[model samples]
Target chain A: MHSFKAVFKRELKGYFATPIAYVFLVIFLFFAGYLTFRDGFYEIRQADMRAFFSNLPLLFVFMVPSTAMRLWAEERKSGSIEILLTLPVTIPQAVIGKFIAAWCFLGIALVLTFPVPLVVCYLGDPDEGLIISGYIGSFLLAGGFLAVGTFFSALSKNQVISFILSVVACGILVYAGMPTTLDYLSNILPAPAVSVIENMSIQMHFHSLLKGVIEFRDIAYFFILIIGWIAACSIILDERKAS
Target chain B: MISVKELRRTFGPIVAVDDISFDVAKGEVLGFLGPNGAGKTTAMRMLACFLAPDSGTATVCGHDIIAEPVAVRESIGYLAENAPAYGEMTVAGFLNFICDARRIAGKAKKEALDRIVPMCAVGSVYHQTIDTLSKGYRRRVGLAQALIHDPDVLILDEPTDGLDPNQKHEVRLLINKMAKDKCIIVSTHILEEVEEVCTRTIIIASGKILVDSTPALLKEKYHCSLDEVFRKVTRTKKSA
Candidate 1:
């Protein structure tokens, strides 16, 4: 636990020590706000963050990966992975510590989108429960995508390769949950298989949480996804150590 | 304070560290001399608890590396070749992070920083980001991080590899100053370094120990200069 806190503290500060954090925030906030109010037409719709919640998954497919791409890739590239592994901490502790720090950084970026919610409240009364749920769902979505990104980050030494791989992986999860994609799959595949694919889709679970329902299954799905990816990450690091 | 018994590490079909065994006692500086790809770094990596051996066992400071890696790690300070560090961090920030990772806190942490800054001669560049620092300064910071916790065992891979002549001398002096009461293993290809700082030397080639003895005895036994002896040992191993 002490090692975890140490790793977390350094990693979180690392983001601000460079311009990467600021660049990611500006890009994420701009697109998130623009997509919700301009593309989704928040002014015409009811006073809720429905559009903001809907657009976040797509934005995160690009943004979250950017945040996570350098986590392990840069460490390996610069040879600092040696320093980290040699520290008085297990592989899982370092992995989880870095992951949580990146996840929280993403959470902060998500929170910075508060102006959208404030604007909605000022214009008219909104479903505060739904807005809060949407924020929770967005945070979870970011966590899930960041996990995928972190896993890819561990696989490569080049941040570019890690970024591209994560974007492709997260993109598939998002599209898998789309209704049209399921319709296409349902034509050839059996209902059971199609349903399973839809259930596994990141968008499917995130969309449910956006409805202000916060169902157990949806929450459980995101948790499982994040945990599974991080576990895979530890396995990779262990293999690297052994070889 | 350090012992290795029949340690082996293989990468696919190639063995990197093949059935090597040696013991390093307190107050002794062991020079790990080897040609490139002789598994010197790999051996040090295993000792530092950064890599696991394929077979056999090693212990540092009375703790088994495999059974108690955390204890082994806490008891040793390892400086890898190239001295990699976070480029975005200042020297002081990086040292603080290392201290935190080592679980040093409060007054102890402050004292560790104070002692190491001057010992490393990194005070002038303490606030400079690592990316902006020269190669020598970056290497100094790497050494500083390793020495921060003041571990019982020190494993340095090519400690003076990239430094200029003056910087190299300073690093050797620092290592010499810290040699008392600490078991130090330094891997290097430079033959002069062994005579300069190592009380004992182990020359490795092709993942095998070619010779293990005191530098003066090895020189006397070979009846030649240390450089010639090193070349002859590695060359014969390559042909074999």
Candidate 2:
């Protein structure tokens, strides 16, 4: 618990001490604001926040990786990993704490886009439940992408390599369920395999959450993937130590 | 407080640290003397439990390094080379981060913060971002972080690797002062430092221990001074 607190605090300080946090905020909000409001003539139809929520999953694909790529990769590249590995804390605690910190930072960036929903409410009687559900979905989708980035950050020592790997891994997760891709594979692959692939797609899970149905199954899916990838990360570090 | 036996490490077919062993007593300073690629850093990493031994086991404060890493880490303080702090943190912020990661908190953390700030001369650059600090200041920050928790054992790889003369002198003096209660294992290519501060010294070459003895004894055994002793031990050819 103490180590976790320390790690979390340190991560937060890392953000505020550098311009990465501010730069991310500006770029994220610029895109989100532009997408939601569109120049000066705001014409986002529907009571639901489909415009705000759907773009979030896609935005996280690039933005979250840029934020998380340096977390572990930079430490390894510059050799601070030796210092960290020899610390009193365990690997799992370090991994979990850092992961949570990045996720929380993503949450903060998500919150800065609140004006979009407020504008929607100002424009008309927006469905409050739909906006809230969209937020839940967006949060999970961001968490999922950040987990993938963390796993890649553990694999490579260079930030550029980690970034490239993270983007590719996240890209696969978001598109694995598309009908075009599934159709291309269905002819050669078995039906059950395609079904399994569809179930694992992050896009499918977020779509359900966006509808204001925070089902346990979707939550469980994101949590399981996060735990599984982080477990893989620890295993890699453990194997490196063993050898 | 430290022990090793026939420790070896191999990457594929090449041996990096071969069959080396030594012991370091509490409050004693042992200088790891070696040239580049002589397994000095590898041996230190193994001692610190950052890497595993392929064929042998070692212990820190009587706990097996391979079997009890958390215990070994708890007992050891290490300053790795390159002074690798998060570039996005200030000096004080980085030290605080290290303190937290090491689980030093409350009164203990305050005491450490007070003691190490001056000991490392990090006050002038307390809030300066680490990414902007000069190499010498960065090195001091690294030392501060390593000493924040005040562990019983210390492993420093190249303490004066990139420091100016004044910085080097200060760091050496600090190590001498800090040696009162802690066992220190330091690797340095500078042979003069061994005579100045270390009670015992060992020379390694090509992943093998070439000589291990007190500086005076080693000088007498080779019938030469410390510089000559270093040259003789590091000679590429081995004695039959």
Candidate 3:
């Protein structure tokens, strides 16, 4: 736990130490607001957070991966990974510590969007419960994508490659649960297989929580996905250190 | 104290650290002389618990590296080549983070920093970002980091690789000052470093031990200077 706090503090501070935090914050807030107001038609529609919740998966497709791609890739490139692992910290502790730091940074960025919800409350009567659920769901989804990003970052030493690969991998997960994508799969495959594919998509689980219904299954799905990816990341790190 | 028995490591078809064994006791500086890619770094990595060997076992401070890697890591301070550090961090900040990682905190952490900063002559650059510091200062910060915990074993891989002659002499002096109570391993291609600071020297080639003896004994046996002995030994292994 002590080692975890040490790593977490440094990694979190690292984000703000460079221009990465500012760049990420500006890009995240700009696109999130633009996508919600433009596509969801915030002015033209009812005063609900549906637009904000619906756009989160797409926004995270780009933002969360950027946050995670640097976790290990930068260390490897600069040769600091050797220093990190050789410390009294274990590989799993380092992985978890970094993951928490990135996750918390994303959480902070998400909180910065509080003005959107405040505006919704000002405009008209909206489902407060739904908005809160949407925030929880969005945070979970961000974690899922960050885990995928962390895994790919550990797999590659190049940050650009790590970013591109994570974006593509997360894209597929988000793409898998789209209604149109499921419709297309249904025509070629059997009903059970299509359902399985639909069930596996990150968007499907995320959408369930956005409905203001905090189901145990939905939360478990994200936890399982995040833990699975982080485990793979730890394995990759250990293997790379050995070979 | 450190001991290795039949240690071996391979990278797919290439053997980076072939079967080799040696022991290093306290109060001795073992100069690891080897050509590039001759498994010097790999062996140090194994002893430092950064890399695990494929076959054989090594113990540091009486703890098995494989069985008690975290304990092994706790007892050794390893400085890799080029002295890598976070570019954006100040020397003090980096050392503080290392102290935190080493699980030292509060007053003890401050004391550790206080002891090493002046010992390494890094006080001037305590506030400057590491990227902005010169190469010699960066190496000093790296050395300072390794000495922060004052571990029983010190594994420095090319501690003075790209320094000027005066900087190299300064580093040698630092090593000499710390040589009495620690098992120090300084891997270098420079033969002069062996004579200057190392009490014993082990020359390796092709991932194998070419010679392991005291500097004076190695000179007497080869009937030549340490530089010529290094060239001849490494050259013969390359051709063989």
What pairs collide in candidate 1? Answer: none
lDDT of each residue in A74-174, candidate 3, tens digit only: 88889888888889999999999999999999999999999999998898888989988999999999999999999999999989999999999999999
lDDT of 1 by residue, A1-243 (tens): 899999999999999999999988898888888888776555566887777788888888899889999999988888999998898989999999999999999989987988888998998899899999888898899899999999999988889999999999999999998999999999999999999999999988887888888999999998999999999999987886433
Write the residue-wise lDDT of candidate 1 on B1-240 in tens digits.
999999999899999999999999999999999888999999999999888989999999999999999999999999989999999999989999999999999999999999999999999999999999998998899999999999889999999988999999998988888898799999988888889999999989878999999999988998999999899888998898
User: Docking quality tier of candidate 1?
Assistant: high
Recovered share of real interface contacts in candidate 1: 0.89
What shift in Å separates residue A97 of candidate 2 from its native position after superposition? 1.5
DockQ of prediction 2:
0.65
Better lDDT candidate (1, 2): 1
The deviation in Å at residue B186 for candidate 2 is 1.2
Better of 1 and 3 by DockQ: 1
* Candidate 2 residue pairs in clash (backbone atoms < 3 Å): none
- Report the alpha-carbon TM-score of model 2 versus the true structure: 0.94
Error of 2 at A58 (Å): 2.0
Error of 3 at A124 (Å): 1.8
Q: Is candidate 1 or candidate 2 better by TM-score?
A: 1
lDDT of 2 at B66: 86
